[model samples]
Target: MTGSREALPDVDGSGLTLGDRAAIALTEYRNGNHQALGELVREATPLLWHTVRAQGVEHDAAEDVVQSTWVALVRHAETIAEPKAVLKWLLVTAKRAAWEAVRKHRDDEKRRTELPDDSPEHPTSLPAKDPLPDAQVLSDERDRILWSSLQQLPRRCQELLRLVSLADRPDYRYISAAIGMPMGSIGSTRGRCLAKLRTILDEQGDFSWT
Candidate 1:
């Protein structure tokens, strides 16, 4: 069921900008409004999903890590004083949860194999196959170059740009939450990420995509 906070009026067509609405939601949660927290989670899931995946966690495992992070947020809600800080808390918490899960998986495998802890199985690596469409090798190379350019961004910038690129909400609240920035900052962050990507491509001399 959607939370009571879901009934909150959408601040913009984007379904509520992260600033006022998120701040209110956190305040509601702090005042013992649990449903408000649920609404916040629903609105924020896509950001969390992208955040965990950007850390090299696979889709399924990352999903689990994100959920666990939200659960942790609820448990720690009393301690988090600022609503604006939720996004940052969620991002860092999700990444750490992902790493913790990876570590546990490795330890489990080591115990099963009767090996030293140092011999624990490695986390499954990111898929290495180029995601290029079926095409000539030259086109595939270009695709790889573009993706490599994306990977070169700072971890937070990569997550922000990736989500913003796919944003459907005209108001861009999703983009703001995904990047943990104020609504006013979304436009500038977009420009900065674009500029960084451009510089990377320019440095690599792969202006063919332009």
Candidate 2:
């Protein structure tokens, strides 16, 4: 774990880079669907891992940096001017976070020497850590509007909707895994979910598609 190593995802395997899929994923995420993010992370975590570790961050700390960078992306996706440049943005952010981690770890070591074991410990001296991945919040106006529409769907429909929308391709097997739907039912469930979503949008006047 201490050694630096790169784990690059095979673009040919997915037929596209994580950044290449960012536009689609962002649209799903803005609608408050986290399944899109799971897809993004699967495609991009390797690149992010390499970037963070390239900064001399140890494996464990680098892992944390990579996670935080993704969390930041979720939080800031709506504001990023170029969605196509998602990978570049993530690498840059991870590098910065890596540097901060290295500096703080070094400083923490130095300060530990200043305080003898008998000295009263001051928790404030420790650097603040980024929130755990699940604790991070993703939001924006578009997210709010989309979420309002999604909320109207039945729970089963919401699950199907999120799975179908975020997947790069319609894989019934995957839907079976994601939502425990039998193969025979996946197609109908997806169709119904989409129809329900459209109906909710129209009824709520969420958006008018020409």
Best by TM-score: 1
lDDT of 1 by residue, 47-156 (tens): 67766665566567777898888888888876765565556566668767766766676566556665343422443343343234455653676666767888888866
The residue ranges of model 1 lying beyond 4 angstroms of the native Cα positions read: 1-16, 106-157, 163-192, 198-210
Runs of candidate 2 exceeding 4 Å displacement:
1-15, 113-210
What's the TM for model 2?
0.44
- TM for candidate 1 is 0.55
Kindly state the number of residue pairs that clash in model 1.
0
Against the hidden true structure, what lDDT does model 2 obtain?
A: 0.62
Whole-structure CA lDDT of model 1: 0.66
Deviation from native of the Cα of residue 120 in model 2, angstroms = 31
The top-ranked prediction according to lDDT is: 1
lDDT by residue for model 2 (15-69), tens: 6544556545665566678786788788767656654554556667888998899
